[model samples]
Target: MNLLKTLAAISSMTMLSRITGLLRDSLFARAFGASDYTDAFNIAFRLPNLLRRLFGEGAFSQAFVPILAEYKSQKGDAATRTLIDHVANTLVWATLATSVVGIIGAPIVLYVIASGLEGPAFDAGVVMTRLMFPYILCMSFVVLAGAVLNTWREFKIPAFTPVLWNLSSIFFSLFMVKYFDVPIYSMAVAVMVGGVLQVGIQIPALKRIGMLPRLSINPFAGLSDPGVRRILKKMGPAVFAVSAAQISLLINTNIASRLGAGSVSVLQYADRLMEFPTGMLGVALGTVLLPSLSKANADGDPAEYSALLDWGLRLTFLLALPAAVGLATLAEPLIATLFNYGAFNARAVTAATAPLMAYAAGLLGIILVKILAPAFYARQDIRTPVKIAVGVLIATQLMNLVFVPVLGVAGLALSIGLGACINASFLFTGLRRRAIYVPHAGWLAFFLKVVVAVALMGAVAWFSQAQLDWAALRAHPLLRAGALFLIIGASAAVYFAVLLALGFRPRHFMRRAK
Candidate 1:
């Protein structure tokens, strides 16, 4: 597939999911607000979710996909087919064991993650964690299934999986929050149910494409397999790099929990908004680039590899820049307009806004890391990035300790921004030293263009924030969000128009089909 066409497909599917997630979170904010139980729920849910990303999605996918892609490339359909069965069955059994252990050991796990939030909050958190712990087993297999489909150049199913998570949570928060008067555990159930659906939805899609994977619990299929072993070897460093971000996030949570009763909720709320753009741009770019880049790197196509790296970076910055500006400039207006309803109040609004802006500061770094790290992974140089990533984690957590005492929870967001900046620097340095993906002077121009666009866009958002209809925000949230979207969108238009007038064609990096 052509670059833009492929990106559009991934982005469109991801957009559906992200939009649905926004609707879900809006409801969750109202239902739970920024309360102790809500804060506890965020901790409870994030613990297993954190591990899920660490081991399965972030760590495993980084390893699994490259190997699977290589298997398809060198060994052909039959070879890749068997490898998939071996990997899937092996992972399923492992995830099952982990989930069972997590379920039984929920209390200790909860305490380990968050010792500060005791009493009802801690108790509720443990219970919620127990309910959600098995999600690891359910979703770990989902990642394996996604790896299978992704190797076949199929991204729609995996991209679509997240939509269920958002929609299910939204449904429970809106319908059940009022009628049943249930605690946060109800939302936990929604998350677990979503995991089941996430994996289940992919099965039929895989079957339709003649890639439906079967699980037979084979430990030997991957044993000593050259490609698989290489993946495992390379995965060591990728885990370190990934752990940097994950560890930084956990530190942010850990610090946020100690701030006060609702600090964790505020940070989570802000972080989720930060995630929306990162999800839409960074993740979409990374996912699309990985398989293609792996093939190019494996084939030793230096020119194609550099060209693709440039393409990913350009798109990453182009989209990420404005989002950062928009979030930073309009944090309060956006939060007040969308989530400041029902249970979510003025206090919650005040708490979440600053951290969202803090996250905006490092938005570019966030996207750049996703764009560059894959270049190393494409070469199986996971250890280099991992070391750098670990350094970043240490620096960020240390900084969080110093800052959080004075800045409160917003300090955690600032530390996150710092961590991303460090991660990007390390990844870019490695990519340059490797001399595999060097850039032209045009990259500097692209950087300047993104900055100019965001500056112009931020100005427009600041002006429009005052003009927002408060009554509409209070009465019809969707309408208010639509208006807010339009305001920032129009601003983005002006910014892009300026960029095109200046020099950016938007298609130079994103080459079109003939």
Candidate 2:
């Protein structure tokens, strides 16, 4: 596969999703602002989203892709198709059962996650959680189809599917709010609509590949299949391994719930911005690399696997470092310009800025985890990541305890970053010790060049931000946007120019693994 081409496809679509997500967030802030309503929505939306991460994108993909790759490599077409049907049937039943229970137990779950909630916020959370729980079921099916399509080397449709979600949320939140009388409820329903769209949009691709599964009512139908058992077995540890980030965010949210109103919203807003680069680069690369690595592993080629991982790490460092610097230096302006309308005031922006910067500091660390964890998973080594994740979770919570009182929500963001750093460190060290990933020479020099380029970019951004009059710019939305764009453009131009001078080129990243 052309790794660069695949990454480009996914990144472009992810960029669209992120842009619409920002627009949705902007509309959300304008309509609901950072209040009990938005807080409730964040909590409710997070419940299913957390599961989506744990199951849809995280554990399921980690366990599914490599095994599917193995099936494709070693089994005939008929066997592979059978495997797909069995897995899909089993997954659908599981997701539906989980969603049903979640909907029924929404209040109990809400209370545990947000004990500080009372009155309207608590009630709203329960209602919205029930409304959004079906999203988990819809998206599980979507992820199943996506996994099949990805295994078939059909990347575009699956990558593009997320756009439906953002569009659904933006449309309903903006236009459908009046029909429901409550804006958050409208948004929650839109999320369910989006989930259905996300699943529906992938069907054509799955059909085109001839891998779409027949619906089966029997949940245990796949238990008779050995492949299904393998998937279930792998899923157990992969769940914990892949859920580390979500767990950290959950911890932050629960802690923020007690810190006062809007704290959760602020962290959510900051995280959305932080995710833009991570999704575009880190996620894009990981999505492409995983299948490629899995193919190599299935072929019993450890050298190629190591080389693919190295290439991914190099690409991540190049992209994530400058992005981290840009976000950290321009956090205030970014938050103020994007989310400073309606009920989102200067105080809200101020509260969000620090967390944005703190989170940005760990952008590279988190992206590294995305790049590195697949190394273990592609080889079907789930236990290492599970252990690393548990240790990181502990370290993160400890940081939260020490920093929350001192730094507030920003401290929680900082703790997440710290955890990412620790997680990446442990993963890297383990890979080296086991000789699972052998680094290519020149990584040190390559990393240094990237660091130097980022430093220059950060300095320019910091200087530009200092010289610009934020108060004057903030008075005019267009001017604020224009100024922000100028800063971003200038910083990007400088960063790339420095890299070009340092002999970096697009072809360097595009080079085939090994």
Flag clash pairs in model 1: 241-386
By lDDT, the best candidate is: 2
Model 1, total clashes: 1
What would the TM-scores of all predictions be? 0.95, 0.98
lDDT of 1: 0.80
Between which residue pairs do clashes occur in model 2? Answer: none
Model 1, 82-162: lDDT tens digits are 777666766677778888898899888887777778898898888888889889988888888777777677888898898
Alpha-carbon lDDT of model 2: 0.88
* Stretches > 4 Å off in candidate 2: none
lDDT of each: 0.80, 0.88
